[model samples]
Target: MRLEAVGRRYGARGPWVLRGVDLDVPGGQVLRVEGANGSGKSTVLRILAGIDRPTTGRVSGRPRTAYVPERFPPALPFDAHGYLVHLGRVHGLGGRTAARRAERWLECFGIAGYARTPLAQLSKGTCQKVAVAQALVAEPELLVLDEAWTGLDEDARAVLDDAVRARSAAGGTVVFVDHDPRRLAADTTAAHRVQDARLVPVPPDAAGGPRVVIEATGGGVPPAGLAYEPAAPGTLQVTVPAAESDAVLRRLLAAAPPWHIRSVRPAQPPTEPA
Candidate 1:
């Protein structure tokens, strides 16, 4: 999906919240958007998620989208499971399939016990898990999150982190805005910041200086958002910033069965174009 020169404003004469925003959201990658508070970051996400429309230009090829906004209505009448199933159906899932997926994600987030509890009765942290679960129940083609991890507990947060990677690896486009700079920083395929009412690219090394090369083998289909090249017959090379090397390593080790590390060292200088 792509946003072409998109801009948004509250009223006919209101000042623009976003202007000349051009973004290309590709499949099979995790995209991170950053900006200071009140910098129109949420506006961009809303537009991308189809919650808000742009006053100028257009968004094209948007697929099945699911959004987790900063604030969720806690007083909703339905229980967590029912709400998720409803959203799943809204996203085109059949009744049985939606119910099955709802149960699965609730279990994954450690909230299976609260499946029948009313949204109004759940604790704040538990409600946040519901919010995250609603978006993932149908396996959306585009997942948009705005501080979705803010209220999650440690285990739930880790589950969400893995969920984001899983979504991207399954060929979905995941776009997120989180206050924590380290949240998925290493796994991001691209980063951008909302600035002066415009979206601008952020260099890969902006988060950390220099880069490190990680060579490993036996990890099938490296986690999405990481760039890798086949090395030896059974090995692959992944280059990430030094500061994010640890996070990268953790991701590798966190995978089921894990990866066998062959080496971690400074990346060699890039070769000049002929």
Candidate 2:
């Protein structure tokens, strides 16, 4: 699936959430979209999910996409599980199939007890789980999630993480927003960040490449790091050039001193001939 030069606008006064956005996400791949709070991240996801059409652009793919929005019909007059069941049916699943799938996801997310609980009575995290399970229940070829980790406990989070990996492994594509660099350090995953109203590459750590872990921000996403994992404890690294060492040091201090900062070192020089 891909979006080419997509753009959207709410009204004359409304700014274009997404413009000239180009994305190419193949099946069996995880494409993470990350940014500040209102950089049109959600807007872009919705467009990909086929919920909203781009104001000016083109998208091509026939795979059934499942979108788990940030908000749903919670605190309403409906049983949480009941709503999920109904949603499954809407997605072309029948009684036996829907029930079985819902049960599995609920159990996986540790929310099976809320199967019959009222939607209004469930916690924020529980609601989030239900929303995610709904998207997965359809067994979609494309999964579109908006802040999928919004409200989930560690256990539940693990379940969803495993599910995502499993789905992608099974030839599914995923486009979701996340603020955790640690969670997306896998080699197979490719990430992009929305900044200056555009997308930029977020290269995951690959072998010896030095990367910094920073929770800095410019616009949309929250305080999240965009650096590679440190190879060793007390080692702070970054992908930027050595010329920016001072800036990187400042940001590191802002993120909090490393467990042990023997000293700040510039880029390592290559060894000469033996």
Per-candidate TM-score against the hidden true structure: 0.91, 0.73
Off by over 4 Å in 2: 205-274
- lDDT per residue for candidate 2 within 1-274, as digits (tens), equals 7778877888877787777888888888778887888887888788889999888889987478899997876866667677777778888999889889989888888889998999888888888988899888888898887878767888877677666766776789888887664453441368787876777677643234453333222222111333344554434334444333444444344443223224444455567999
Which 10-residue span in candidate 1 carries the lowest summed lDDT?
219-228
Clashing pairs in 1: none
Residue-level lDDT tens digits of model 1 in 1-274: 9999999999999989899998899998899899999999999999999999999999999999999999999899899999999999999999999999999999998989999999999999999999999999978899999999999988998898888888888899899999988888777888899988999999877755688899999977676567788998878888877877888899888777688899999988889999
For candidate 2, the TM-score is 0.73
Local accuracy by lDDT, each model: 0.90, 0.71
Give stretches of model 1 more than 4 Å off: 229-231, 255-257, 266-274
